[model samples]
Target: MITVVTNVDLFSTFQHVLQPLTLKPLQVVLAYSGGLDSHVLLHLLARYQHLYPQHAYLAVHVHHGLSDNADAWLGHCQQTAAALGINFIAEKVVLNVGRRESLEAQARTARYQAIAKHLNNGSLLLLGQHLDDQLETFLLQLKRGAGVKGLSAMAAQMPFSLQENCLIVRPLLTHPQQMLVDYASQAQLSWVEDESNNDQSYDRNFLRHQIIPSLKLRWPGIAHAVHRSAELCAEQQALADEIAEIDVVTCAHSFSGLNIAGLAKLSKIRRNNVMRFWLAAQYLPMPSRHHLDKVWLEVVNAADDANPQLRWQAGEFRRYQGVLYNQQQYAALKDVVITLEHTLSQRITLPDNIGTLHLQDLIQDTIHNKSGVDSSNAIGDNDSGCCVKAPLAHDKVTIRFRGEGTCHPVGRSGSRSIKKLYQEYQVAPWLRDRIPLIYYGEALVCAVGLWVCKGYEAQAGLYWHVTRER
Candidate 1:
């Protein structure tokens, strides 16, 4: 039975839902879209704010620019918020329609990313997702053959972003959409109707308009039942996550890398669970079952000496030295040579998002009196503290990603090829070309953070440092 809600009952329910959250007087931001659901929520929040004036209220509208009336909708939201005496902020986002994902998915992602900017560490973001929305989401995930985590649907309350410490709360999640309509009608509220909502081309609209209405006619309590099932799935997912957490600790290596040996000890199902959890921790997109199987059969199970890699749209998985590493696909740097003049202190920005290079004059007091020491016989220091002799006025100094010939680094005996030096220093094969190499004309002088050339070592002169962007 769908019971009509009075204005007083709606406000009271809103207050009851948010009572626990008001203890700290946190900023409450409503994702206001000037639609029926959000307008009702904003009206209720305005009434609640009158009683609990300690908590700050803000209405944020994300302009996706997808609809023709997007600007008009923004104006309506601004006017409504001003009348309600709540702070208002509007953000415009550009959607990448060319991506492989659906337009609906792109819009939702852009909306949240735009809204996430205004949220502080402890801010509360209120969404207007009601029971009907939850039902549609549940059915959509079910149609996709989702697992427990996906079938759980939208959470009523969850951390928006762990790094931001922001909480997203849906106060109206338990309430029916009809109840919101009733409250809005009784309150004499005016809200905009999005034409896109009636477009049956979208999956959610098809479910909402054609499929769900019949389902409700057959089973009036279908929303409640679906909500209950989603809640059960959420509970089961929480338990699975707890198990994954324990397994991840045992399998993880160096921060982002996973030890293949430790992973091989687990069963196939448990191993996949750990992989999903590990990828989530790295903020990488979850791979499909086919892709995940490829990761296991092709990458992790590859021969110890074979270099295997798997690339996806968001990120890639690479196996090196018996460890699986999830890494972003960085574009290959071009052979762009950058000239560095003799300056006391200078910072050079590398292309292709490589990072900045800092060059500063070494203090004279830090230099050891090596006049008695033979310069050619001195070994070069491979540590970051290593400094190079300042280039002469006629010296053509440059920075390059490609280097050749032999380099005798400090603290190392004799000279070795650049490739040999890379292997000896344990530099990853993928990162060897990315390391900035300092050159005096054609001769390699310093490998930035790796080592300074033996004869070019300065007792007190310019020091080179490279800071990676990623």
Candidate 2:
């Protein structure tokens, strides 16, 4: 058992010092599992909410539905939240702890994913992991032989770029488990002990029960020391990021995907860092060290004309026609076309553009900020609707597969081939095939948002619309 401290001054941490500059007036969601650590965190957040009423607070409990007592634990969590006068939400998710993933890691990923659903565009998701957890993570990274980034471990606060927007803030990284237990006892808060946590079958458990304790007995402050080492590594990582940003700009070209020619000029270490930075920017899974070596040999050393390809778990990368493209393989669009028979007067959302469709929905006041409007025509009084036809379904509107075509943009007198247009607009080849084209049953109405034919002009009073996005 770990020795406990009676009191914890939560406000003295590095985070509190940086709170003025860092903290946003956003919702704070805690991944509460009714476990010792999360329970302590939930209590701290409750206290924090009382202090800062401007920021919203919520406790999310994810029910994996794995344990027999899952429902009972959820009930306990609900009661605890009610007693604390904090909003509580629960989510149930299925976890398949297959051969590749341990039950602990699988459950962790699912639980956090569920908690992330409660977050909004500017919210903060706080986690309860402590110093010991950081040490374990460091050991795991070492076992996998990860480089500097992995060794840096988790950041104290970092923006999490999920579809459900928020930043994942780890405020408890500086604290140890004993400090949390001490705080819980002093605060008289009750929390459940997960039986699975003690099971030696899990790798983390084995490390916690068998290895860490033995190591701790020899060096009492091992976890803290390791935590310090991780901090230093983290600082080094920030420096690396600074250097990488500069290198990336120098070695990159807007036209040729990632300038493989420019990348070849840097030393091997700088080359690897630049590659990793670019991959991170694209959100592709970082390739293994060996894979990076392979890519370097292929991209930098191979003949300029050679097309090289590298693939990993998340996505694939290919070089073609002096431009390298990274793509996530997806199913091809169905050959079928679906049409809406709604009247033009009715506000109808087109099939593909989920965000925007009709002209009325467009922000009139914000029109000045937007570019690429047909400027030569009237002083923007009537936004072009393409054709002034009476409210009728007579216009053969169908979503068609992108095919070889010639486009005569509204202002341009002559037509240009699709391939040439793509080049002129600097649209990547992968994006060209992905752009949706609306067809008037053989005649291309518009390249969605790209360009509309000069022949099809929207006059003052009729109804027509088109939209597109990157």
Candidate 3:
């Protein structure tokens, strides 16, 4: 039932929703769009702040620049925030209109990204999505044949995507749009109306203008019914997530991948559920049903000797030696050779996020220490078993990603191919080229973090270490 909200009832509703949150004296940011719903929320927050002045309050407006009147709307938001005695910030974001996703989605992503920049950990962000907006989202997800997670619709409160411990809260989610309108009318609020809202080209606008009004007329309590359904879906999804978490703990491999053998023991339904949960944990986009099926049939169930992979837009799933790995798509590393100065102690930054190589000139340090050991003797000896040798003064020391000939490592007796060594070391195939190969002129010295070539073992001079980027 749509309750007619007076000023007192509206304030009571706001207090009832916020009281349970038990919010500390944190930064409270309101997403004020200068629209009716947000304007009503802004008024209620101003009143709430007046009563409880412990929390810091601010209003932020995201200007998408999609509408010609966007500048005017921003001005209205600024003026209204100032009148309410709240700090205000306006962020302008560029939208990728030509992208495959709808313009509405692009605008929303850009807006949230802009807002996320202003928030710190544990900040509270308030949105103005009411029950009517929730209904629209639920209907749209249904149209797309969504599962429980999608059908759960917009959550009343959720963790902010960009910041840990930050929350995105919609206090007005349980109230219908009529309540907001009634409150705004009673409060004599003024707000800007975006012209784009009337355009039926957008799916949301079409639903708001045509579909929902008729539905409300036919079934007076449809909004509450849809809201109940969404809440039920959210509850069911939470239960499924719990089961997936327990399954993940059992099937997790040592290398941060899933164990296919362990997964095979579970039923197909449970396996699929666990796979989705695993992908989400890796922060990869959820794959389509077809792609998920391909992961099971082609990657997980492939012949033991044959490598199998299933790729999607954001990432890929690959099976290697009974383990399933989820990897985000990375750009191919170029064959770039970098020269290093052996005379000085320095750090070299590698390309393609491989991290840095630190070279310490032990001989230089020993000379500075005025030690009894002769520097010449240290340079001449080649039996220290260190991963890197002190290079000759005229030797062109360089680093490369690829190696040519076979190498006899310091601990190993015989020579072997680089590929064979990597296999012996159990290195994944995709990471083979990313390993930095140290070289003195054309002779391979060491594959960092792996092994040093027997001929290039250091006697007592330079030492090298590799630190990978997180």
| Model 2 regions lying over 4 Å from their true place | 1-5, 11-25, 99-105, 163-165, 250-256, 299-307, 334-401, 409-416, 419-431, 436-470
Ranked by lDDT, top first? 1, 3, 2
User: Which of the numbered candidates is closest to the native, going by highest TM-score?
Assistant: 2
Q: Which is the better candidate, 2 or 3, if ranked by TM-score?
A: 2
Worst 10 residues of 1 by lDDT: 370-379
Model 3 lDDT-worst window of ten = 378-387
Instruction: Tell me the spans in candidate 1 whose CA falls farther than 4 Å from its real position.
Output: 1-8, 331-427, 431-470
Show model 3 residue runs off by greater than 4 Å: 1-8, 254-256, 331-427, 431-470
lDDT for residue 187 in candidate 2, whole number 0-100: 74
Residue 126 lDDT in candidate 2: 78
**Could you tell me every candidate's TM-score relative to the true structure?**
0.74, 0.77, 0.74
lDDT by residue for model 3 (115-154), tens: 8888877888999999999999999988888899889999
Residues 1-470, candidate 2: write the lDDT tens digits.
11224557654452383366336677778888899888877776666666677777789999998889899999999999877778999999998756576677788778767876778887777788888899888888888888878888877878776634567778888787888877788778899878888888877888888988888899999888888888888888889889889998877654225776677779989888888887787656578888888776775456877666677676667765455556556445546454646433334443333223443212231354343334334222323334332323457665554557687877777989978977765566665655555566577766544566666545442333443221
Report how far residue 374 has shifted in candidate 3, in Å.
44
- In model 2, what are the clashing residue pairs, if there are any? 386-457, 386-458, 387-458
- Candidate 1's TM-score reads 0.74
Candidates 2 and 3 compared: the better one by lDDT is 3
